[model samples]
Target: QLRETLGIELPTNDAPPTSLETATPTQPVVPQSDHQCQSNQDQSPEPLDTSERQNSDLRAQSTEPLHTSEPQNSDLRAQSSEIIPVSSKEFMSVSSLIRGRVKLEDVNKTYQMIWTRFKEEGKTDPLTPGDMYKMGLKVTGQTGEAKLKVLRALKIVHISNKGAVKLL
Candidate 1:
C-alpha cells in the first residue's frame, strides 16, 4: 500500500527489479501531477554537486582565458603581440639563432682554411674551447664566444676536458 502511494517498489539487494519498474528501463520515472507539463520531453538534467566542483577545479587549473565561439578581437588581424606562439614556424633552432648573426657554412669554411694552415705546422691535437673562443672572437668579433656554438653546430670544432677546443 505504501509502495503504491510512492509510485515505486523499493527492491531488496538480492531481488530483481519488478515488471512495473522494468517496463520503461530506458526512461526516467517522473511523478505525474494534477497540473499539465509544459513539454513532453525532459530538458536540463538533474544538477550534480560534483559537476560544479569540476567546473571550479577546471577554472582554478587554467592560467589562460577560456575560448569563446565569437571572434573576440575587433580588428580581425593576426595577433602579433604574443611571441613564441603555439606554432612551430615561430620558433628558432640554436643553429638558426647562430645563423642570424653569422653564417655557419662560411664560418666553418674559414675555420677549415685556417685549420689546414695550422695542421701543416704540425698542430694535430684538437683545439680547446679557449682556442675556439679566440677563433670565434677573431672571426665573428663576438666577445661572448658564441661563434664557438656555430662551430660546434657545424661539427668542425670541439671542446676538450681542459676547456680547450679541437678540430674534428
Candidate 2:
C-alpha cells in the first residue's frame, strides 16, 4: 500500500506514447534567438490525438474545485470527494499541480519552460534526461519523479535510450 501511494518511480514496463517528433517530421532543434522563439510562438502547435483528447476530457470532467496550489498528502488538508485507490490517486495528485484537469496542457507549458530555460543558459543541445527531469520537478511542482512520468505518459516529452531529453 505504501508503495502504491509513493509511486515515486515510474515503471519502465509501462511505456510512454509515441511522441510528436516520431508522429510527425523531426521538430527542428530550437534555435538560440529571441526572434526564433517569437516566430515559433506566433505559430500554433499541432492538434491533439485521440489519447490527448481522452486525457483532456477526463480533466474537464473533474468536479473538484481548483486549488491555487495543489494539495499535499499530509495532515491539515481537506480531502476531496473522489476517493480513488492510493496509487492512482497519488499520480493524479501530481497533475493537480496544474490549474485544471487538463494536465497535458500543463506538460506543454512545462516543456516551454524547459526550452526557454535551456536557451537562457545559452545551450542549444537537448538536456540530459536527468537534467530535464530535475527541471520537470520545478516546473510541475510534483515531488519524486512523478512529473517526469506524467510528461512521458502525455507524449509531451521523450527520454531516449541514450538519456537525451527531447520536447515533443
Which residue pairs does candidate 1 place in steric collision? Answer: 126-166, 127-165, 127-166, 128-164, 128-165, 129-164, 129-165
Write candidate 2's Cα lDDT for 10-94 as tens digits.
5555567655434555565445576755766588889999999999898887856657575443321114322212234444655
| TM-scores vs. true structure, each candidate | 0.31, 0.27
Best by lDDT: 2
Q: Give per-residue CA lDDT, model 1, range 19-76, as digits (tens).
A: 5677686876665773466564655565659989899788886757656696522222
Give candidate 2's TM-score: 0.27
lDDT of each: 0.51, 0.52
lDDT of 2 at 132: 59
Cα error, candidate 1, residue 111 (Å):
1.3
Per-model root-mean-square deviation over C-alphas: 19.1, 29.9
